[model samples]
Target chain A: MTHTEAGRYLRLVVAEEAPRTGDTPDSGARRVWEIAFGLAARRRFETDSPLAEIGRTVTAAVRSAALPLLEAEMLVREALGEQVPVDGIAESVRTAVHLLVFARLADELALTDDELDSLIAQAEELAAAGISPRSEPTGVP
Target chain B: MGQTGTLYTAAGRLLLDALGEKSPARSLSHCAGSPGAVRLLRELFTVAVRRGFVGRDPRDITAYVRDLLDYQSLPAGGEFARQAEAVMRSVLGEPEVAYAVSDRRRFELICLMVGDLVRPPGVPTGELVALMRQAERRAARS
Candidate 1:
């Protein structure tokens, strides 16, 4: 899968859904942020922490109505100490987030099993190349 | 089943009606034009979700937010917006969780929450009350 494959897949899926009722322009980017935060939470806390546990922590931060990202970063840094790679984690988080968000969206859009497999393969290729999914233009314009 | 059982029941019908046969964006655009609709939409998603509106669905609310932003001509994706979306999605996905706040007496509870989140708080108290009355009447008729 080339760097643009996952995005292409998303566009194809979006084409099937109604344009006006489709996902937001920033859904892809938002998913990136969510993924990064989730990964940092897991790494900063227990490596084996259940997804639900990390999800709870993330949810609490978001509901604080305060600075949620700051709160999440603070929590992760406090747990992982000062040496955590904030930039590196964020870089890797972009791809991870895209993978997670698209996988769910695919299901919601009723993409076939074969289509899902192809999308995952493309994502894996992007991740393996160390190419941040954020580098891809979201075509929002 | 909180203290405002009657109000919630009435409000639920109103919400369903407001959303009837319209995409979330279209519905929100209609709300954007009316302060009463704005108050109801805001409260139903923010306050009601926190106060045990079991019917709350995050995907639906996300679409609501997306449309509301479009209605206001505000940018859709920001850190806070994304985080808020995640919060709604997480809360709705969870099962048997406790509410964050409970205030049946304050009918304007949603107005306050949404006002703080968005600017130029939409009061229109008279309008919202009228809308509620209309909803109650329609509910009665049905």
Candidate 2:
């Protein structure tokens, strides 16, 4: 349920289900990014126009080491279904997705409690500073 | 994952690769429209279901569906939405009344249809599944 836990789950599932070298090639991280950005967009802007609020969260995620700025922006654009060119951001996007969407997908996939905890210990090691990739704007406005 | 599920995953991957090679457009959307393509897809699904690839594991089915949708680039709500619906009704044999379901169900059916397109003839079902499981186990460690 935590960010690190989410990251690990994303890593495992992507590795298992979306292996890098395959015919149906994919970037698991990109898929993760789409889910997170998509969820955040839906929550904040479902009723009124909150593009600024969404943009700020996105800008901050990009500003942080959690995700690259342009990649995060393009992901937001893609989640909105824009057909923009997002070349060279796949790796960065995947890392961000690893940080953001794991917990959310756990619920959607009905993962078991044990499965949810599968990589928590390893994930905790990655975020010793306690900062996660949730779009909460760590130090930027 | 069970041996059966793992095997199906592997077979599914091979079928997906084969589809890309054989199809004119390298997409299920194109294949769905052609009568010849539909027959080929039906055969693939028959082989998979008979071998217990799907229907046994929801997770397996879910993963397969996601991959198919992504690979085929078929949006849940897009130009091909109606095509997906038709495929579901014909393939799953849902009652005519069930045709008016939500977009989400239609999307799920489309994913199912796409996943079923990876049909390889003459290969022993048990052998294919076993081979995929072995490959999966090795891949997990690497």
Candidate 3:
């Protein structure tokens, strides 16, 4: 399939998966920043200008899923190191897993804007307090 | 992909039967004392805990695995090695190598791993396969 076809397929897969993950959708500055920074880290460019805000929004979302977030973080770190193709099957597998979980939860739980804001706020406080490895699951590294 | 006919071997068959859905093999590594079994069980656990539905579309999964093969390693040919290298740099993960595989390749690898794990301990193989089958069926039903 062409990149456009593959890319569209991926977006659709992610869309279906987003509902599975139930991630609360947000357009907050923080969310924008988080996605932006993430894209930049991967040497990706996005139309969204305020990456920092997107980053913060995603941070709150990450803090909430704690365990899954870490699982995903490690996977991506591993993927980047491996240089998995952008639209390859493995990338799809990993990305779908994360997107599904977060998106489903975000959509299903439907946390109020204030509730989400507070969660992020709490997460920020925890960060300030140096809550390292928040809820780290025990396992051999 | 070198199809290790290991699954057809006595040990491999024992493992496939053992780790089947009926019994849903419990950390076979615990008593089996086999690295292969340990790895198999580990894969099962990771796959279970992480992926919700094993993806009803097996073809999609096969494609995903095939895409993965492009990442881990390549055949010792100029045309092939270059492509493999490109994939490795872009998409594959650490575990991808150990399971370094593609579509039908994944089935072969999983079969080999499971076969190896359940072979030594024959009795447990039967028991475990039953368990795995059950779990898989349940997952499918859910």
lDDT by residue for model 2 (B40-66), tens: 444444344435442332223323434
What is each candidate's DockQ, to 2 decimals? 0.04, 0.02, 0.02
lDDT of 1 by residue, B1-142 (tens): 2114335443444454554433433444444545445555544444335543346433344455455455556545543333444445444554222232233312232332233232334335554444444444444443
**Model 2 segments more than 4 A misplaced:** A1-33, A46-51, A97-141, B1-142
Model 1 chain A: ten consecutive residues of lowest lDDT: A132-141
* True-structure lDDT of candidate 3: 0.34
Model 1 pairs in collision: none
Instruction: Give the alpha carbon lDDT tens digit for every residue of A1-141 in model 3.
Output: 222222223234324531343443332322322232232223321222132333333344454544333234333322223222233224333443444333433343465545434433443344345443222222211
Candidates' TM-scores?
A: 0.28, 0.25, 0.27
| Model 1 agreement with the true structure over A44-98: per-residue lDDT tens digits | 3453234345445544434433323323432343232222212323433443333
Identify the leading candidate in terms of DockQ.
Answer: 1
Residue range A1-141, candidate 2, lDDT tens digits: 554433544545534453344333244334433454354444434322343444455554444444543344334544444442344455645455434444333443455656545444333442453433334321111
Interface RMSD of each: 9.9, 15.8, 14.7
Give the Å error, residue A17, model 1.
Answer: 39
Question: Candidate 1: misplaced stretches above 4 Å?
Answer: A1-90, A96-141, B1-46, B50-53, B87-142
lDDT of each: 0.40, 0.42, 0.34
Provide the lDDT at B18 for model 2: 47
